[model samples]
Target: MTKQQVNKVVLAYSGGLDTSAIVPWLKENYNCEVVAFVADVGQGADELAGVEEKAIASGASSCYVVDLKAQLVNDVIVPTLKTGALYEGQYLLGTAVARPVIAAAQVEIARKVGADALAHGCTGKGNDQVRFEAAFAALAPDLQVIAPWREWHLTSRPQLLAYLEERGIPCSASITKIYSRDANLWHISTEGGELEDPWNAPSSQVWCWTTEPEQAPDTAEHLSLSFHQGEWVGLNGEAIDPVSAIDTLNQIAGAHGVGRLDMVENRLVGMKSRGCYETPAGAVLYAALQGLESLVLDRSSQDYRIRLGHEFAQLLYDGRWFTPLREVMQVAAEKLAEPLTGEVVLKLYKGQITLTQKQSPNSLYSSAFATFDEDDVYHQHHAEGFIRLYSLASRIRALQQASATDPQSGGTS
Candidate 1:
């Protein structure tokens, strides 16, 4: 494997500074034809606009801009909601979960164009390299993977800029750019810059998707979310697909600054990194579904699902979505989600989404059984027998101790 045997490569292009430089570098180093593939996972129109032109300008033979937003929301996001997967209890695994879908699409594009290899602009220390390469291995093991950052000698932003400049490549980015960001339909994550220092607070410049909590409106906004068999089919009583539903929630929740998190998280590559994330719509959805789970699932069932949810979230963050363990977890979650049909009312105000109320058609809640007042349904006398049987082992242990102390009945016993 000293030298790859690929003649053509499909590179995941983002139209960003690194990827823009990667287009020409792939050709110059590998001596292969380069095709740029961009997956539109609803990062936004601004990022996608003129992306093809930029790719071509960077020396790509051709550019393929495919829309992946619908698939991302319907296939990935909707199914994930059923599992209640939240990374490390709060992170939401935003970029981690979104990577598989994007990488899968990139692989598909490579196959369609008959490329012998794949390329990505992910840095050496980032988790995305493992995610993208793992998918390539699972889907197309024969194809080679060329990771520029891991192979090239360019160490700094200045060096990368110099390489692009030497090749006469056009790039607007400068050394002043301090942050690395990834945006999609679910969330937007910001890293580098001041975030690298955990002691430093995330300045206003670090945030974009969410309004400042203090700047949020004084009034709270209430909304109704409807779900059928675990899928969020309609928002605000209006029928909509998963993609539109996410957008609608993002708009509403973003307005109130409902989702903002600044934390030091452990990366899959075994590094602790600090970052800020804004997941406005995802926050509202999680609060709603968790409440719905409490209504539909029994105590024991809910407990097990929650335990499994934690594991599922961890696996997702580690980029093991294609593994058998992940499949098993997903299957179990889907079975539990069958009874999750309900409506939840949420109150959003200043970065907080409160579950005001929730009702499920298959709700296991029964006020009669749980009432503290006198009720004919549950006989008081029945509890005496039940308690005796339940604590029989404890009762036996106490009787043995009493017998041992009765020295009068049996001397020196």
Candidate 2:
């Protein structure tokens, strides 16, 4: 790649220590004007407040805090839920799926600001670098891509602290920062520190969004969730928007510590990393929607949908969200969710979500046909013929094997 004559650069700025440091570093190293682009994907106001001031203080020419909460829920979260795309059977893909939406908007900001280069604060060892760069290549291949962690000589925290101090940058960060955390409306994940050791149990200090399971209330709580074509529409018989619905569930579910997952998952970069996640709303939604799917989808369709979901999960985990295969699989998953107009009642108790009752307008379940008691709809004798035909090949194969081993019996033909 040729050296880019970068006059201005647009950066995906989170106003965190890494990105706060990146703004001035871009100016010093590339000698370019820096534009901070912050995507407001419902991470919360505390993280967003004073961000513009911080960006300017960090030597950015201007800052753009683009609101993407509605778009993210509609475009990314809902569609992902349709496919049941859980990474490695544990993760909800909260950060993995949120990257594409953030990157696409960053590209737009780069073009709007007339910046010739794109910069991100993702480190060399993580998967976000590939996610951001891959989306950049697909969206704006002409822009120069700069990842500071891959090129910077300052590898240690003490060096970064000294560099920031030299630049007169005020950061409320310390070398003793235990966990690396990322949060959005969907979930919050914690990595590094004690999490690096798989044998070490996650302490109470590691959890922020949820109550400890043992400390949860003694009595269980029941909540009803309604879904229409995979989008959560109602909660406890009240119509609510996607954002509000998720927030409500998060509050309710978190109180009971309904969503805490500690697992070691394989990253896209071929490394296994341990993390603890709190996904209160996501856990409830997954259980309720799956219950609805069981009521709606037929036997063969259910089988195929489960297989397709696993493939889609891999695509999402690997940061292939913008590809044609993602679109193809999403369309198929949407088709399977056409009958998912139902309400599911779930009991939340001590970090467990159990599907207690479910009712759907398009349910495939029939009590009359399934009853063990006498029913006019189904005859017991008919099953004998059905079983005989179903096992005919097995019966014939067994007889042939027996005759081959016993030549005297084969003489009768």
Candidate 3:
């Protein structure tokens, strides 16, 4: 795309250091009017505060802050929960899933404001650049996508800071903050600093939304969670809103140090990066949902659900949220989730949530069939015939080996 033809550009801005620097960089390089777009996916009030002023001060013509918290939880998070999708078996894909929604919103804002180009602060080396670009390509193919990080001379944080400082852009950030952190209603992730090394343990400062295991209280807490068609509706029998329900779980689980993970995951850009994440609410919710699944789902159905969960996790992690595959997986997950209505009682201890009990109307577990005591429901001798058939191939292989080794047996036996 030619810079002379571009008049205006809409940016997916977070009011962060990179984004703040990108605003002025776009104006200087492309010579286009930059409009900043911020999506509020429950990161925090402090992050959202003074965003408009920050954008305008950073050389943006106008700033649009769209509230996406409700939509995020209801539309994206809940559907993902239905599949029990966890990226690499640990991450909740908080940042990964949020990108598509943010990008989609930016495209919408660009269309509304009559912008000719879309810009993002994602670096060329990261997974986010692929995610954002793929989303823009899928949603707004006509709009020229501008990635300053890929094109600009500004490389490191110090260089960007220097540029911003030279422009007299007042930012409330400093180099003293060691770790790069991202937080939403679901989870908080930390990268950089000590986390750069895989051997180094995560320090106390690494966690923001959750308490350290050692710092947690000794007393255990019991809470009941109720779900209907995969959506959580109540806590301890009290009906609550989605935000409040998740918030309550976070407080309850975080107090017990229930969710903390450290992993080096493969990025979409074919590089590995280490990150420490705290997902208290998400952990508790996953445990409760699995407990409900145990009660409701049959053997074959449960196996399929597990497979779908893995696929869904990969899709979400790879930022394929708006695609047909995502829609199909979500539909299947929703169908499976229909019988998942139930209540689960979980005991939250130091960094552990044990499912104490689970009850569902559609439960397949039968007390009579599971009893160890003598009952007419199951015959004790039935296992003998079943075991013989199950191990027939193994037994036949052993017999063949014995016959071949025998002195009296022929070589062709």
TM-scores for all candidates: the values are: 0.95, 0.96, 0.95
Task: Specify the poorest-scoring 10-residue window by lDDT in model 3.
Answer: 404-413
Stretches > 4 Å off in candidate 1: 1-4, 374-377, 396-413
Please give the distance, in angstroms, between residue 370's alpha carbon in candidate 3 and its true position after superposition.
1.1
List runs of model 2 lying over 4 Å from the truth: 1-4, 409-413
Kindly give the number of clashing pairs for every candidate.
0, 0, 0
Clashing pairs in 2: none
Best by TM-score: 2
The candidate with the higher lDDT, 1 or 3, is 3
Model 3: CA > 4 A from native? 373-377, 395-413
Against the true structure, candidate 3 has what lDDT? 0.89
Report how far off residue 17 is in candidate 1 (Å): 1.5
Q: What digit string (tens of lDDT, one per residue) describes model 3 on residues 46-86? A: 98999999999999999999988787788889999999898
Model 1 clash pairs are none
Between 2 and 3, whose TM-score is larger? 2
**All candidates' lDDT scores?**
0.87, 0.89, 0.89
How would you encode candidate 1's per-residue C-alpha lDDT over 1-413 as one tens digit per residue? 33446688999999988888888878878888999999998889999989999999999999999888888877778778889888888888789878888888888988899998899998888888988888888888988899999888887789888888998888878877889889998999999898888889899999988999899999999999898998887787888777867877888899899889998888888888888999999999889999999898988989988888899888888778778898888899999999999999999998888999899879988787778766877877889999999999999998888887789757355
